[model samples]
Target: MSAEATPLSIHLADDAATALFGEDLLLALQIGDCVALYGDLGAGKSTLSRALIRALAGDPDLEVPSPTFTLVQSYDLKIPIAHFDLYRLSDESELDELGLEEALAEGICLIEWPSKAGRALPKNRIEIHLAFAPDGGRTLTIQAPEGRLSRLRRVIEIRRFLDGHGHKEAHRQHLTGDASNRAYEHVYPVDGSARLVLMDAPKRPNGPPIRDGKPYSQLVHLAEDVRPFVAIGQALRERGFAAPNVLAQDLDAGLLLLEDLGEDGVLDSEGRPIAERYRASAACLAAIHDKPFDREIVLPGGHRHRIPDFDRAAMKFEGELLLDWHLPWKRDGQLATVEERTRYLAIWDKLIDEISDADTSIVMRDFHSPNIIWREDRDGYDRVGLIDFQDAMIGPAAYDLVSLVQDARVTIERPLMDQLMADYLSLRAMGPDFDESRFLKSWAIMSAQRACKLNGLWVRLKDRDGKPGYMRHLPRTLWHLTVAFEHPVLAPLRNWCIEAGIELPESPA
Candidate 1:
């Protein structure tokens, strides 16, 4: 990390604004973070720290007495934090005596008057300086190390960006994110109306080339920035689809201010899949796929983002994730031998092009339940709102249709899947060139390929990334793959599964 990285600065309008700033800071705080707060007496350092601690504890009314006398106030919250008052310390050595060093290693530490501790502060700590304003507000200057606090820096940058764009006093509330590194916040304006979603999708480096000297992301045409999102989103909205309106954007920085699609989705209160919503979502896919699209889309500022084709190599890479990640994890480190590996690749090599699209229509890779927001108040297809479609590609329309009916996250009952597929096909029948048999075959092939990818991806998320939340979906993935095999197009995949000793879960009777 370079010391030359720019520092972040933010201005506060009042005490409430300072508290809001503190909440924003806490969004980036993790265990082992040391926030060195520097400010003069009554400069609202403690006030900001108090708000941060309270937000972490999830108690707005939690009493946070100053630790001036105690020197340290420890909270037994979700992530244990230590609040330290270094004002009365005699020298830097007192930090050790007060166990501040140990607390820094154990949990997050917020230190007021960090200058009193002098050089004892951690080198990678986030440094914040506050100053009094004549209007009784505060000015906060924040400096975070480049790599460690990159997300923190991006959060503040996005906040300031929004502030400059008519959301200066918008209140931010955290929204649960997916397994990806992206984070979202619901931004409510000061007037308490018109909420927006702030997407803090910082640009990430492409990993080392995994196959054929190309990174997996590049190979699969994964979205590396917000441009694909903006382009694909505008294309969808322009076609009268329910893709969110991009209120504002910072494409290079991977930040976006998007319209809040509200909390309603294609799921019930108990979180089961809603049949009506799923049918409508399937119809939405029909509407999108039936249209003609171009590989290259022109975006705002005269910039062009070309949608990549889901070609032969991309399909092969996805299919191999089952062998590369999931199979090894499932076998407890026992990997496929050279023969099994050859057979797996050979099968995909033969069938890849059969399922692969030839730059047909946009296939939003993740058109599943979780990404579909069901706005009941909207008219017609608008009720099925789309989110998380940044990784759009020019693929077979059947791909997104398979994604909708046979979702990885939710169990679409066989009847529901059948009904949704029927609903979808009926809509496509309205078009002139709809080839029913080929499209159904595409559905089968795409469904099988998707199941294989999900199986491997969920396992990779758990075994490689140390996230076990995806384990619960493994059975469903296998079951979906088994269902796909009922179609003759996936016979090769079924045979390979048998040869590799990959047990397909039995279909529900």
Candidate 2:
């Protein structure tokens, strides 16, 4: 083991505590992880393994038979697990025949009596030594590779946070996370009552300065901590929107127990956009834009969250994503020339200048299908429950509308998108000083801006972040840009794209 392999000790008072520890381990575990359990005959290795397997299966009643006789037993769950009891193995080389390598390649592995394997185990396996305590309980000494120690420590912190609150016995189930660093979990009470959401967002550390001594996140005004969510959600709720209520919070720790806004999003059962829900969402945005909003929002404990402006710097920075990531990716590792970058940025500068006096509101930076919840029980604008607005900024009202009508994740047909746009425009036109022509121009500029940002963002997420799935949206974003360039304001960008060999489809699909 490396010199940095430090052991963490934990005492489990009873079976329930041991089970909870298993759940914590599940949270920390990833695919290809090997957990080696070391204990004597009557220690809690089997108990811990069973608890972890059951938790991964999301079934408390799952039958996890011991693999002692079989040597290896596999379970096909969310993250496939292979439970191995190598005590019966006669030779270490038999591990290959038992598919130990395959198990570790495809999913997680739990090994009991791992000593039988000799040096066949992976070097970075997590080791858990369990022993009987003097008080008839169990004690565990756990050590993991240095690269994985941070995740294990985070799991321990989450458990402590839950215990400090009134949810020591809550059953935790992992929820799908977004592209950001934040993660979430469903916390169910011991009594099987309503569930809550645990937002586990750690404060983001500053990266190497990209420009003017600021990182990309700071330039684009991304939320660094959970305070923005707390403040923005409170502001939205006070304005009659259905943002999730904060049940409990730890600002310093970036943890929040939020009311579980149910999983009915704007998409239907088949993952297609529901027209009525889309219209409702547009109306909700209109209602939000029409209201007067304060720049500084008072959070709990009298602290304030000052909403940042979507300034020219932010807009230019985002537009450059296309130049930085997408263009190079399209050209097979060849970067854009200095002159091409200068021209692309110049076009963006003009577009941003054109939208200088456009309608301003508290723009939810990601007001799209994924962030929108369809609350059927609620009426009017309240029917649309908002989440994931921590990165909200004060910017062009048309930007949110663009996010909805031209959703990044889903393809919204031109007809339905037009109707949704009309739904929002008609409502906003009733307000004082609403200029249809100017708003449409701003809408076109913002649409093209968003398209440029997303085109580069998808490539960055794929190449730099190891997330290739986001690349699937590249075609749709290109289509959106093509549509945006139909407006006269984006003609310069359209010509530049054509000159740069970026294809723009002539017709919508």
Candidate 3:
């Protein structure tokens, strides 16, 4: 171990504390981690291991038998786990027969009595030493490599946050995480009556400057901290929308305890879009756009979050993702030539100019299915719960409509998408000064722009981030792009894509 590796000590007052520690540790663990437990007989090693395994299984009452006699116990879970008791091993080489290497390769391995394995143990494993405390409790000292220690410390910080907020005994279950660094958990109270969501979004550091001494996120106006979410969510809730109420927050820490909006989304159990829910969501967007909104929102503690404009530069930067990532990935690392890229940017420049005078509103940048929730028990617009709107911008209202009807993640059939567009237009038309002709043109431009961004974003996620699962949405996004090109405003871009050998479905008659 490196000399810089420091030991973190904790007091476990009882079994509950140990179990909570196990759950906290689960948040920090990833695949290929090895945790070596050192403790004397009946020193609470078994308790901690069992709690961790049960938490990983997401079943608190799961039966986790001791592996003392069997030597090893393996579980196939969300992330597979292998529990090993090295006490019975006669030689260090016996680890080979026990599949230690294979276990470490696939998932986490928790080893008890690791001293028996001697030098065969992993060099970078986390070491946890449990001992009896003078006050009749257990004291645990943990030492881990720097990378793991950082994550562990973050998890502990979150635990302390919860403890301060009167949820010291709440159960934390991993809910969902997105492509960004933000993660969420369902916090169930001890009484199990109601659940809340814990948003763990640490303030992101600025990346290497991609353009004009600013990172891509800054150029595109992405939220770097939780302030925008708090401000926007409060604004939405005050407008009587179903944005979750912020219960507690640590602004600097980027943590928020939010009202749980329930699990019912706009998709059916089979993941197909429900037309009624989609229509409701469209109507909700129309309602949001109809009202005149304030650009500068005052947050709690007298802080202000001024929404940024989705300007021409931001749109161009996003559209260039297609050239930067998608084309290279599709063409086997062949980048777009300077001439081709110039032509592409010229086309987008004209399109953005055309939409410059279009109707503007607070654009929830990602108003798609994944970010929407369905609240059937509510009525009208309240039935559509809005989540994940931290990246709000003052932009063309039609951009959000395109995001909805041409959802990148799911296939919105032509008929349904048309119906949704019509419904949204009719609703907007009811308001004063609505221009369908101008709105349609802006919608077409934004649709193509968003499709370009997503097409490259999916590839970038796969190649750069090692998240290949996002590639599954490539065909859907491509199809959406083809649909967008069906608009007369996008004809030039369509021709450019064709000349560049970008495969797009034929525009329908």
Please list the C-alpha lDDT of all candidates, in the order they appear.
Answer: 0.84, 0.91, 0.90
Instruction: Put down candidate 3 lDDT per residue, 183-221, tens digits, no spaces.
Output: 999998887768999999999889999989999899999
lDDT for 5 (candidate 2): 64
TM-score of 1: 0.86
lDDT of 2 by residue, 277-320 (tens): 99999999999999878899998699899999999999999999
- Supply every candidate's count of residue pairs whose N, Cα or C atoms clash at under 3 angstroms: 0, 0, 0
Q: After superposition, how far is residue 404 of candidate 3 from its true place, in Å?
A: 1.4
Candidate 1 local lDDT, 399-487, one digit each (tens): 88888888888788898999998998899888987888888887888888898898899988887788899988888888989999999
Candidate 1 residue runs with Cα over 4 Å from true position: 1-14, 36-41, 54-145, 356-360, 507-509
Q: In candidate 1, where is summed lDDT lowest over 10 consecutive residues? A: 351-360
Between candidates 2 and 3, the lDDT winner: 2
lDDT of 1 at 263: 88
Error of 3 at 493 (Å): 0.9
Task: Compute the lDDT for candidate 1.
Answer: 0.84
Model 2 CA deviation exceeding 4 Å by range? 506-509
lDDT of 2: 0.91
C-alpha RMSD values across all candidates: 3.7, 1.3, 1.7
Q: Each prediction's TM-score against the native?
A: 0.86, 0.97, 0.97
Q: Output the better candidate (1/3) by TM-score.
A: 3
